[model samples]
Target: GAGVSQSPSNKVTEKGKDVELRCDPISGHTALYWYRQSLGQGLEFLIYFQGNSAPDKSGLPSDRFSAERTGGSVSTLTIQRTQQEDSAVYLCASSLALIGTSGRAGGELFFGEGSRLTVL
Candidate 1:
């Protein structure tokens, strides 16, 4: 069943123009995460994948941000040349983890209702 979902929840661009955000996870979960919260700021963990491991982007903040999680689920977060501090609110999380992956030892993450980036 679907759970996590994000998309143009709110996006207004114009600065450098370059955006692509979308995420839909929660069907057998394979561990996917991407976060970026501003306007009060506090959740900035750009990437993380489980299953094949080796997909942690170290909280991507520069390089115009980037993300991908194809087969393991659905994920997309690309900001090639946008600016304005890259606006904020692009949260996406998924986790049906078996007993591994993060805090408390991985097992908590089911968010999606974000994707709000405005840079104009």
Candidate 2:
């Protein structure tokens, strides 16, 4: 893929259902990020993965939210027991390097159109 790719561009699930969102980042990119944006709200950081370092999951809202990156390329975010409040646009982004590294002020990020999840 030429850019970040996310699956199931739109999903409507009943409350308490489980949903999995997938992201495939640009080839050779080392950093991947997951963000959530609710209606009329700003993007909320969910998780970050950089190379082999431990993923920064400080932004996960609860134990019901989890994510994993495999082979350093693909990633998946799982939301268990989804609630109406969980409805949002889940975005995935990839960067070649971490911000402020490699002489770059802030590395550029390639973002996917995002997966819109709606819990009814």
Candidate 3:
């Protein structure tokens, strides 16, 4: 794919179940990001991966949420003991340049059609 790709676009799970979401970023992009959007929370950053290593994971809502990137290409987000409050649209994005630079012009991310998770 030319841009970021996410799997299981729609997931419906029972409360307390575990779920894993997958993301495959654009080739050669060193920066990958995971974000969550819900009614209450407009958008929140979950993690930022530079290559296969995550340097910022402070945005994770709780210990139950985790993510990892492998080979600097594919990434996975896992949720443990899922709660109803965890239901939201998970978005993935990638960019060729490093993010959060002081004066980088036109630094944009290619985002995937978010994976919608529903906890019932």
Candidate 4:
């Protein structure tokens, strides 16, 4: 893919259901991130993965939220037992290098349109 790609642009589900969102980043990008945006609010960092490094899962809001990156190219975010508060736009981004590092244009990020998840 030329840019970050997210699937199922809109999803409406009942409370307590599970949702899986997918992301395919641009080829050769080394870093991937997951973020959440509530209506009228700013992006909240969810998780981050860097090449061969331990993923930073510190931002996940609860145990029900988890993500995994495989082969350093694709990623998935799964939300279990969805709640109304979990409704939001899930965004995925990729960068060639870590932000603030040398080269790679200061870690420019390419973002996907985002997957909108609604819990009824």
lDDT of each: 0.80, 0.90, 0.90, 0.88
The TM-scores, one per candidate, come to: 0.31, 0.93, 0.93, 0.91
Residue-level lDDT of model 2, residues 2-91, one tens digit each, is 989999899999999999999999999898889999999999999888974545778999999999898999999999999999999999
How far residue 101's Cα lies from its native spot in candidate 3, in Å, is: 2.4
Better of 1 and 2 by lDDT: 2
Off by over 4 Å in 1: 13-32, 35-45, 49-57, 62-82, 85-93, 98-116
> What is the per-residue lDDT of model 1 for residues 1-120, given as tens digits with 9 covering 90 to 100?
467988979999999899999988888877778888999879888877774353567678787787777777787889988999989988988887733624435447788889899998
**Native-referenced Cα lDDT, model 4:** 0.88
- Higher-lDDT candidate among 1 and 3? 3
Best by TM-score: 3
Give the count of colliding residue pairs in each prediction: 1, 0, 0, 0
Q: Rank the candidates by lDDT, best first.
A: 2, 3, 4, 1
Model 3: runs farther than 4 Å from truth? Answer: 105-107
lDDT of 3 by residue, 6-111 (tens): 9989999999999999999999988888999987778788898989898778899999999988888999999999999999999998988766675543347888
Q: Whole-model lDDT for model 1 versus the true structure?
A: 0.80
Error of 4 at 99 (Å): 1.4
Model 4, range 1-120, lDDT digits (tens) per residue? 477899989999999999999999989989888899999999998988896353578899999998888898889899999999999999999898776567555349889999999999
Least well predicted 10-residue stretch by lDDT in candidate 2: 98-107
